[model samples]
Target: MISVYIGMGSNLDGPVAQLEQAILTLTNHTELHNIAVSPIYSSKPVGPQDQPDYANAVMRLDTKLSAIALLDLLQSVEQEQRRVRDRHWGPRTLDLDILLYGDELIDTPRLSVPHPYMLERGFVIQPLNDLSPELMLANGRRVQEHLSQLDTSDLVIIKEV
Candidate 1:
């Protein structure tokens, strides 16, 4: 199994419950095991301000699935949670992103590992730091190093899972 870090967020249809249920679904998946989740955080929306704030968290999973296959599973989970992608970074019942897939750096039409913008997004960095502060990115930078450069003023801890 490989280590995978996933970023989960929700702003619609009871954001907290949506996140909780999504985590539960991941834990129940046969291919995904040893799931560890960080504390839930409430953050201002990254896109249109018209939508509500999002509840976000990071999940660490040991998985036997390939990166693309894992992406498919996450999308399915979003669909099951009634996610709609009508708008970019729009409000959704659930949003799951493959933040880091082991130490591999992948850039394909469908997926990007290290999440491209993770270093700039406090919502992703904060919880990721909570999970593994010493984690090194594909490029070799430490998780806490990137996190320290971000402005986390918009993020607030809701509670542990």
Candidate 2:
């Protein structure tokens, strides 16, 4: 099985509940195992500031499927939760991204591993740090070191979320 990290966020239709439910869905998936999730964080929208703040978290799981196959499953989960792509970085019921895929460097037209913008996004960095502080990103920086370089003052841990 391949170890993978998935980033999940929501800003519409009860963001917290949406996130919690998505985690449950991933946990229940038959093909996934040893699932672990980070504490959710609340942060300003990464795109248009006009939208509601986002609830974000990161998940780690072991899967027997290929990257593309896992992406398909994640997209299906988003669609099942009514995610819409009406606008770039727009409000979404659920937005799931493949942050890392077992240290693989994937660059397909449909996906990119180590998520292109992850290192710079507080919403992604903070929660990811919560799960694996010592994790070494593909860029050769420890997760803790990378997280420290970013301004995470705006990130608020949503305890018991």
For each candidate, give its TM-score against the true structure: 0.97, 0.97
Please, what are the lDDT tens digits per residue for candidate 2 over residues 1-161? 89899999999999999999999999999999999998888999987888999999999999999999999999999999999999999999999999999999999999999799999898898888888999988889899998889999998889453
- lDDT of model 2 at position 70: 96
* Runs of candidate 2 exceeding 4 Å displacement: none
- Candidate 1 on 22-82: residue-level lDDT in tens? 9988899899988999999999998799999999999999998999999999999999998
**Residue 103: error of model 1 in Å?**
0.8
Report lDDT per candidate.
0.93, 0.92
